[model samples]
Target: MSILFGLLAVIIVLAIAYAMSNDRKNVNFIGIGVMLLAQVLTTWFMFMTPIGEAVINFISDIFNKLIEFGTEGVNFVLGGVTVEENASVFFFNVLLIIIFFSTILSVLTYLKVLPFIIKYLGWGNF
Candidate 1:
């Protein structure tokens, strides 16, 4: 995931450079608009239903893994700290829950989730 995000960053930078070089003023606006929309939708979904739980769990899992790794290093230096009965797993579960939802949101958006959202949400009213 980190590698993918790094690649995305690189691609975005190159795209920005190309857009600027081409002098397409509207391109920047469009790019920003898309980003804003994606972020808003992501945030909205973050608060809803089982999807929210899934996303939280996913992120929590990532964090727990990192924390566990650090704890291992700490233990190696200080003769080990005992875990509190599956606490790590619980954290991971939460993280995975969140991440899963977020992943779904990303996939949906990539597949033009907005049209569905708009139609269902009656965004036309706005």
Candidate 2:
């Protein structure tokens, strides 16, 4: 089964690491086991918990909104421009997002808003 293969892969990787390690005598097995267990638990928590789902959804929503705003700006200027599917239409779309983000960033920097945001974020006030 796939689960058996996954376990085998983990064991093989650990064996290779142990073989290549310079300080094999000082290798802390307890720390390695704890970290592996933490990885598994963190993976499970992210995909299985409602709070994790909400966190993911919130970030997704923010990204989607930003992209939507970018598209709006792109369409405002190039709405009449037509392109074929085999061309660089997708490239232009991505470029629009970057352009919109840069424009906002420049404006924020000019207004000294970025420093305020960075200062508070650095201080963990948010």
lDDT of each: 0.67, 0.84
The lDDT of model 1 is 0.67
lDDT for 117 (candidate 1): 88
In order of appearance, the predictions have TM-scores of 0.39, 0.52
Tens digits of per-residue lDDT, candidate 1, 3-121, equal 69976996798687776775665456566657657766886788776888799889999878866665555557547545567477643435545655566568888898866886787
Clashes of each: 22, 0
95: Cα error in model 2, Å: 1.5
- Cα lDDT over the full model 2: 0.84
